[model samples]
Target: MPLDRRQFFQASAALGASFALPAPLLAAEKGKERRIDLVSSAFTVALDPSGASRSAVWGFNEQLPGPTLRFRRGERVHLAVKNELPQETAVHWHGLRVPNAMDGVPGVTQHPIATGGRFDYRFELRDSGTFWYHPHQASFEQVPRGLYGALIVEEEKPPSVDRDEVWVLSDMKLDNQRQPVEDFGRILDIANDGRIGNQILVNGLVAGSQRTLTIRSGERLRLRLINAASARFFRLAIDGHEARIIAFDGQGVTPHPLPAGGLALGPGMRVDLIIDCMGSPGQSFPLRDLGRPPATPTVLGALTYSSQPALRSKPLASAVTLAPNRIAEPDLAKASDHYIIFQGGMRGSPVIGLVDGKPSRIQEIMAKQGLAWTMNYNAQHEHALMHEPLLHLRTGEHVMLHMINETDFLHPMHLHGHFFRVLAVDGKPTPHREWRDTVIMGPRQSIDVAFVADNPGEWMYHCHILDHAAGGMMGTIVVE
Candidate 1:
């Protein structure tokens, strides 16, 4: 039977509602500054197929999901990491700018911190917002199982809020025995969409529950949402309350009212929203994801109002009209737009899809490298350039890159070391003027991103889905 559009939505909603859960973990307090000592050690934990439960690892601070390292912007950040894992490892301060040497890109900036090694990451917090850290080596595996955490850089002049909560949404793939499913870098790509799993989780639990909180009416609350899933894009919304979007990807932005409709969150993307609880005095407002299926409740969590005196008529603070960072806007008129098609399937069979007109052959490459993993239709092999695309631009030239999605799933396209503005969609002007480091492209859809290649380096442009990236959705752009 063909799936009706409405019926499809209903089925998806059912999948979403399969579970509702209580807030899974304890949240950190506002205005608290602390030091962190993280030890990345290798250990084994039990796993069902989905790899969702408390599995074994190689993790930071000896725990999966690593340790939550909290610090205030403008304050000194002291991170002492000790590695006990068998292999050498390095921590890349994803989305944070410290120093080139301290960037921790393993081969690029610093040497890998070997087993029983200790390294100190010391830097001044220049930005106040949400960020995270994970291994730079084998990041594809380390981050998927465990070894990642929230690196919240708090604002010096905190927002006028009574409380704040940080939520990291992720997914897992388990085997039939309910243990973490693993291909261990040998699975055929064409049979599945890279490393996507069957189980979905928010901060480490299945859906169909609630994360409850209490706040006085009229008080302001900040909700920081991070999509840490390896290969999922989230459409997040709060049930009854409206959330004003204040930032993206850790950079503060001009505010936009949300919960009027929810927002889309890509992997490596972050949104900070402020909600007022005094609207109905005692109403229960759940933060929902209208983007998901109806059967599956979109409620990320709930914000309950306490019986406090309502300030008759109080309005939330309007967005601050701050200029974007001091950077020159690129001239789009004279700039060139590049079109890159994301296409592939089984490795050696020569399926029709190719990135720029070249098929990715797993066995061919493995024969050259003496490896065992052969490419299936979707082998994550390198989709190299026949000739490097001319990407270098004048320091201030504005250029648009059109990404066309030809696959069955979503791809969170990300650019390293720089950010860009969304100029249009399918050739039409962008409805929302938001700047981002990563943009999620849906099947059959096209997106245009504008950016000035100001930061010069051999930076990577790839799918943020680590598995897809490993299979070959990876490339580099040189900014001269």
Candidate 2:
């Protein structure tokens, strides 16, 4: 029998509720800054309703998403990472601007911590926004296996909200047994869309048992959505509500209504939404993923109103204002213009390029690393996290990059430690003029982005596609 819409939704809810919901990991409490220990080790997590089916993976503190490390802007964080896994690993603070020596890129900033060894990461939190931490060494394998967590830096006086929530979105490839598929890098996958997973998880919860956010009618919420996926780009919408975008990629922006179509969140990107629950009491609305196919919109979670009387019938305010960060506006007049071409992938015309300063062919890259991607005709084959700076600049210099995408795929290019003002897309200027740490580039398209070289350090810039980055689509920037 064909399933109707109601039946389909009921089935989905049943599937989600069949498994035991894991206890939510609490964010570190606000207090004096002190040393925190995180252990990287192998663990088992249930990805299916059966509960018997578990995937063996590596994680921090043996938790699926580790812990949510919370801090106030300007507070010092001292973390000691203990590696219990067999191989070496290092944590990269995804969007924080820290001293180069503590940046956590193995071999770039520091050597990887060997098995049973510990490394201390001491840095001051400078930015207040949604950021993340994950293994920079062998990230293609480490991140996908589940060694990642949310790092939230709160502003001194945070916006008034009934509740604050962090949603970290991720996916995992699974086998018939509901175990994580062990294939890390297939040439075709690396050359194309990276590793598209078969199962999606929201804050470590699988399909059936994803928690619902319950709120009193007319309550305001601050939802921090982090796209922790290796490659998936989320086109998200909340049914029966409007989400005012308050921030993007850890930087506050002028509040604006989320696009009617949806908010597109690329990998490694974070979006802060101020949502007012206007629905009637006892009603439940879905947070839908419109990016997936039309077969069924992926219901990430539900926003259910409390059974109590409604507080208000309308939204709190039509416009919400947020204090911007200290990021300097890009000086477009004095910006030095540079163009970087992205080429190579599966199904595209073959092109020869340099891999680690040596001339190489597409086939050679595949043979060497099962890679199928390149950035600016350079296939990054270096095992270490460090690479020679692709662009070097003096501190505080304004730089504009024209990233031309020649590949026949979408690449969410991400720059570490700093955010850039999006100048234009495909030659047209952006109306919002928002700042972002990651920007999506479509096939055969070009994007002009400008940023001040204010953070003096060696930072990695690469495709957010983990497989593609591992395959060679990565570079570094040096600001001195």
Top TM-score hit: 2
Candidate 2 per-residue lDDT over residues 428-471, each given as its tens digit: 99877888988999888999999998988888888888888888
Error of 2 at 45 (Å): 2.0
Q: What tens-digit string does per-residue lDDT give for candidate 1 at 33-64? A: 23456668765443222334455445554434
lDDT, each prediction: 0.61, 0.80
- Candidate 2: minimum summed lDDT over ten consecutive residues — where? 18-27
What TM-score do all the candidates reach, one by one? Answer: 0.75, 0.90
Clashes of each: 53, 3
Candidate 2: where are CA atoms >4 Å away?
1-32, 48-50, 208-210, 292-295, 356-360, 382-387
